[model samples]
Target: MATVKVTDLAHQDAQKMLSIINNQMPQLINQLNSTGQQMSDPNNWDGPLAQKFRGEVWPQAKADLEKMKNSLAQLQQSVQKILTNISHAGGA
Candidate 1:
């Protein structure tokens, strides 16, 4: 079995990150849509249950979405850095 070089590993990591980002985007969109729908329903504001559910669930969901977004952004940056390093290494 051949040992993979660091550059090969980095390239694979970048592809994996891109795949994760692509998968998460649709989930993020769905979350946004669901949140919007929940807010748009007039009855959602009329009851204690709704208030409690929103208070407990919405913030967590928002936080999760933010976390995922940040993670995706960081992964993208890392991928870009890896690609740049690979290019520079090849040129050198």
Candidate 2:
């Protein structure tokens, strides 16, 4: 049977990455929301192209953002699971 090894440093690094992802996600979401709001404002941007973007492209972008958020959450969960496994391996 093959052996697998995980180190304390790996666990720490994973935790740090998880923290970074958790922190950055909110900022990303806020930026996207602010951008969407700014673009949606007619006073800020108004034209047929803007309307087309708001009606078509904007919704797709929002959906893509939501998908990305879900993907990040999944990644966080996977990292948490790895941390749990590492702790169980006596690396915690």
Candidate 3:
């Protein structure tokens, strides 16, 4: 079989990674907003469900948001690296 170049693989991976990140961004934003709202509401803080909801669920949601943000940042960096690689390969 044929050997594939690193540049070609990087570009393809970058595109796919960008697509996945873009698709997840809206859902992540919605979750972050919902969690923020819940945390901000005084009633939610004092409620019976607050122990589980706020302590566990909200914290997990916040962690998910952080993970999503980090993933997106990494994906952006990967795309930038791919573009740089492509440009340098073309100029050489």
Candidate 4:
């Protein structure tokens, strides 16, 4: 067995990346909600196939989108914790 340690992770870069992650999370959720509403609009479907897609495929896509949002939320929280830890550790 070998002991391994990680060092040299730039705090400024981590903070910048954290800023981006925080800013984009809401944007992504808003986009998903807007698109989901558009997809649910009945007027958008013209025929049986389109209706089927809206009814069937769209649900899975929506579920996946929800899962993605949840994962992003978790990641955001984790990143926030990391940033807090960084600050506590005398990082930028």
Candidate 5:
């Protein structure tokens, strides 16, 4: 495969994307946490459906959110490495 050149623009774009992810991820987590709390609260919700949701769906969603966070962190690290490499190469 032909090696693609990494430029300053690419690094800038990657940084911007990472910035967006950093900004939005917390909002997503907060929303999930709020919803989870609401659903888990007996006063707010308590029934067979709520029990099933609290037992099943909430955990899966939380786990998936954690996985997504890990994946995004990996992506950010990879991008940082690429940016560092490009900087050392004097390409950015």
Candidate 6:
């Protein structure tokens, strides 16, 4: 049989990381939105490139940023899972 071991320190570290990520995600998303807004501003771009990037690239980048929440949630869930059974094994 195979076994996996997790520790209290690991749980604490995971919790810390999850907390940090949760806190930072909003700021990151805001920055992404700011960038997208800047890209869409006509003053920032003066050529056909604006039609290409603001119309296509910036929009896609913003969409991807929206999807990042789910990915971060999955990471938090994985860490929580590792911390789950650890409590029964003298872990926090």
Candidate number of the best lDDT:
2
Off by over 4 Å in 2: none
lDDT of 6 at 59: 84
Candidate 6 per-residue lDDT over residues 29-51, each given as its tens digit: 88878978887898987589888
TM-score versus the correct structure, for each prediction: 0.55, 0.84, 0.52, 0.72, 0.75, 0.71
Instruction: Estimate, for each residue in 1-92, the C-alpha lDDT of model 5 and write its tens digit.
Output: 86768778887887787786778876887798788868887799889999998899888887888888889888888877777787876776
RMSD to the native, candidate 6? 2.5
Model 3 agreement with the true structure over 23-59: per-residue lDDT tens digits: 7676867777786767757675767676667677777
lDDT of 1 by residue, 39-85 (tens): 74657664776676567766677677778777777877877777677
Q: How close is candidate 2 to the true structure, as a TM-score?
A: 0.84
Candidate 1 wrongly placed segments (more than 4 Å): 1-4, 7-9, 22-48
Better of 3 and 4 by TM-score: 4
Error of 4 at 82 (Å): 0.9
TM-score of 4: 0.72
Q: List per-prediction Cα lDDT, in the order shown.
A: 0.68, 0.87, 0.69, 0.74, 0.81, 0.79
Tens digit per residue, CA lDDT, model 4, 36-90:
7786778964578768767887788878888887887788788888777777666
Instruction: Output the better candidate (4/5) by TM-score.
Output: 5
Error of 6 at 74 (Å): 3.3
Q: Which ten residues in a row have the lowest lDDT in candidate 6?
A: 81-90
**For candidate 4, what is the total of clashing residue pairs?**
0
Per the 3 Å backbone cut-off, how many clashing residue pairs does candidate 2 have? 0
**Pick by TM-score: which candidate is best?**
2
Candidates in descending TM-score order: 2, 5, 4, 6, 1, 3
